[model samples]
Target: MLQTAVLQWPGRWTKKPRAAAPPQFRDSSQPASLTVKSPKLAVTLEPVQHEDFSSLVVSVATTRDRSAFARLFEHYAPRIKSFLLRQGTDPAQAEDLAQETMMSVWRKAAMFDPAKASAGTWIFTIARNLRIDAIRKARRPEFDPEDPAFVPDAEKPADEVINADQMGCMVREAMAELPDEQALVVRMSFFEDKPHAEIAEQLRLPLGTVKSRLRLAMRRIKEHLGDRA
Candidate 1:
């Protein structure tokens, strides 16, 4: 009976349904570049712009952002260093001054405003004030008016004072006769206590040339004031 049922079975076969592809995956052979062009999948990039000190200062004060303060420090510190250097300060001292200036800026960050002055002008003023203070401190000497060694009780005669004033005038006249550049170097070297090498560096001249120029200037002055001393 079983054999007879098998013999009567249908000749056609039924097909099974296939599973769907995953939502994220694509066919390996297909190009992925075409899929990225879809507007919904595209990424948009914006350009980055740099901010100046005024803008950075406002941002730091208003937003309490440390990065903005850093930007300002980076911009001004080197300029302060150069200023000190041009004033005849050594690199180490100039760097210290620059650091001090930057510290002052950080402390006074709240005082900065775009309308009052530019960052460069503000920092230059701070450096200028510091330099004046330094000069004053250097020039201030302890004075004992009555000290026997330091002060003389008897004043010089009117004639002697007149002679000294005349000598000073003659020296000034002699200096005025010198070529402008040579006179400037000599005056700065003598009156300002600037070393010859420093003067040379400041004026951007060779050290030998500075020495030769100074020597010539002194010789001329001595000739002009012959026997005056």
Candidate 2:
């Protein structure tokens, strides 16, 4: 009786049939239908032309232009930093000195007379004064000019002095090989301790040209002395 009942219920009648899927479905393997493209940007930097301070100082002081002050800051900030560094100041202190120097320049812009001193000389003097003040405030021992005990060690031997003289002569000869303009300014600035403006006036050259000549001379001197020193 059980076999007869199972036969009557067929396997197809017991199973559930799935409904058909909708026809609009698409395959996932294919790429998306749309894409986006961004346009490339072109960057252009305008050439910057710096005004020469030697020429602009009179105008800047007269007009009191903020741009001129900006130019001054740009030029002297690094120089003051370098000056302080040379004096053995730490970086933070040197940065502070530079800031102080710039502040002084801003306040004293009216004092900047191109006729009296070149920009470099004016800036150097500011740094030098600051350095002097710093040294003075340290309260180091004061040297007595008349005290024999405080005098420099007795001069080196005559032979050593002669040798030094010979080396100096050789260095001078090397300096003689420099261009006349360069050598002349170097000698005046270094040996005579004359300001660049005075040197320029004496040489009948533009102050900028005088500075350029002196810089070239110094570079040459440094190159020549490198091995000797």
Clashes of 1: 0
lDDT by residue (tens digit), candidate 1, 87-148: 55567876887888878777776776555455655677676666555644554345686677
TM for every model, in the order presented, reads 0.38, 0.39
Off by over 4 Å in 1: 1-51, 135-229
Please provide, for model 2 over 140-166, each residue's C-alpha lDDT reduced to its tens digit, 9 standing for 90 to 100: 355675798876646655543333234
Q: Which ten residues in a row have the lowest lDDT in candidate 2?
A: 5-14
The 0-to-1 C-alpha lDDT of every candidate, in the order given, reads: 0.55, 0.53
Clashing pairs in 2: none
lDDT, candidate 1, at 194: 54
Deviation of model 1 at 21, angstroms: 85
Give model 2's TM-score versus the native structure. 0.39
Overall local distance difference test of candidate 2 = 0.53
Off by over 4 Å in 2: 1-51, 138-229
